[model samples]
Target: MPYAATTGRSIAAVTLIAAAVLPLTGCHHGGGSRPGAPTRPSAAPRPPAPGDRTACTPEMLRFHARGVRHPAHRMLLTVTNYSDRPCDFAAQPYPLLRLGPGQRAVTPAIGPSDPGTVITLAPDATAYAAVTTAADGASGRGERISQFGVALAPHTAPGQVGLDSGPPVRVNPRTARVTYWQSRREAALKW
Candidate 1:
């Protein structure tokens, strides 16, 4: 018994279609429901081209601080590039923020411990750091502070400047900490 020419062609077409569709069924886009599962990662921003890169200095950036809505002791810190060119926020993986004297104000890092890939901010762009202050009850309402100090990542002359807080904040030395500078505000707070 033999098949007609059109029937043979139809079978071949079906085979080809099945082969193409089967492979795609195993593939996924954006990790649909399981965000934690591995998927094609979003493209990361390209690094600054060679010599064009500059370190973001205190003068090049305008810093701001305010309390976070949740987690009562947290503060949201942001630095916006006020310069004419793009710059990298590079250093010990986080911003140097001090709210009190000596070692007492040191905000323990909650993210990368060492300097990693620098987060580049184009002119007018901004970066963020989430600072979790010490618990109030633990410190019996830690030192009341209305301002905090901010320093540039890499050592820069006039390394630090004091930025005013919208309201005085209390921080205890025991548990206060800060996250590494993140490209997004939500990312800074996520930690």
Candidate 2:
């Protein structure tokens, strides 16, 4: 019975020491708080600025010029069907070419004079439109302007007007247009 009591006391003493040391081990010993302790106030993330084109893509490439010469300026715009299912595309309003990033170039409030231009493509298929300019340039001859961007069809695969894979074409600012001698079909899918 004495040996059993001694063994019990030893075990109890060891358990008490272990319990006390375990808690102390967790206590921080440094003069300053632990390293990498998250004390810095979490930085408030800044919101994106208005009219920022951060989400722009190659398929949205588009530009239009019209004068008394041609009532409807011919536009070769690329369109993509992103979904697995086929999609039928109708004419979208001629996107106005803005000079700078902040300006609102295209207004959605204006209705199209004619909207029967529908083009259908199979799933994952990309198509191009030879669209006429919606804006009437009857007042004066607007010089040919070069504008390009990604296609903006909702839920559709992104498409581009110019080929981004090839060497960037240098455009003459004075000419106000970039000439691509390639075929229309070739130009549409290049980007």
Candidate 3:
């Protein structure tokens, strides 16, 4: 091919690429309004920003504990969002569990940690955690626990709640387990 033809093809290619990319450059498609402009609502709801995720404070949640009759050794603890705004919470794998009010040793998370897993609860929404107090025939220390505390964060005190019904819940903190905060009771129980 002649040099001129090669040069012409090169120019055409560059022009085509420039045309395609020009539209993408300096184009702001985010769901944000320009200053002093009439804001247009986004068609789809925007996900909460990272900064918007305030940890669910103790005051914002109400804890409840109840024995699972079907699952003899397991109990369900739920955290209901009593606040007016949405907030985020997660069991850093699992929350710090105290078998009893006087128990000083934080029951370590029993299973693998699911890092970065967080639950965002809206006002009035609830999250559940399935706690396995004592595994039958399992080794380690087993103690009868009628009351327990769930410290959502390291700095905060655990929110204690009594078993609403049934016998005293028995637990071996070393072998005990609590699932990460789940959106539903079924999910928590599955863990």
Candidate 4:
């Protein structure tokens, strides 16, 4: 009986070892299958299912503003998921604006809409928001905008990103509007 118990434990330990090793070996890591002795290909690792993924951290998300040439004056605010997992943005994220040398957070004239359709950003995937500096060609003649302030969470002060490093972008602030984040660039650019 004593021998049987020890054997059982040994078998379990070996099983755990094999479980770890087989995947590595099957991928041609274990001496190349004894010089091509009928080697079998290993399956590629599967990504975690949608439900198994976690929310994106501030570090995992990247923000960029691409200028759009139009009379209305617009920019595409892009948020990219750089992490290995998928993430969801349940509601529209508000952007904090900083302008001139003061670098104060000025709320844009536009407001974000409530939760729209759920958007899931896969790793390296991008979502877009439309930023309009001027609603019309003749409007906002006196408003000046320097840089947008990044905020990781709602109502949080200054995000990890540095938007003020670049040259200031002057625009008519009165008509400026930012649409809610959208899965498609077209949707964000609609307004």
**Most accurate candidate by lDDT:** 3
How close is every model to the real structure, measured as TM-score?
Answer: 0.62, 0.28, 0.64, 0.56
Give the range where candidate 3 is weakest over 10 consecutive residues by summed lDDT: 26-35
Q: Provide backbone clash counts, one per model.
A: 0, 15, 0, 0
Show model 1 residue runs off by greater than 4 Å.
1-52, 102-105, 112-116, 135-139, 154-166
> lDDT by residue for model 3 over 96-139, one digit each (tens)?
78876455677655454343467888999998888887776763
- For model 4, the superposed segments whose C-alpha errors exceed 4 Å read 1-54, 91-115, 137-146, 160-168
The alpha-carbon lDDT assigned to residue 165 of candidate 4 equals 38
Summed over model 3, clashes come to 0
Pitting candidate 1 against candidate 4, the one with the higher lDDT is 1
For residue 59, what is the lDDT in candidate 2? Answer: 35
Better of 1 and 4 by TM-score: 1
State how far residue 15 of model 3 sits from its true place (Å).
66
Give Cα-based local distance difference scores for all models: 0.71, 0.37, 0.75, 0.62
> Which rank order by TM-score, best down to worst?
3, 1, 4, 2
- State the weakest 10-residue window (summed lDDT) of model 2: 173-182
**Cα displacement (Å) at residue 168, model 1:** 1.0
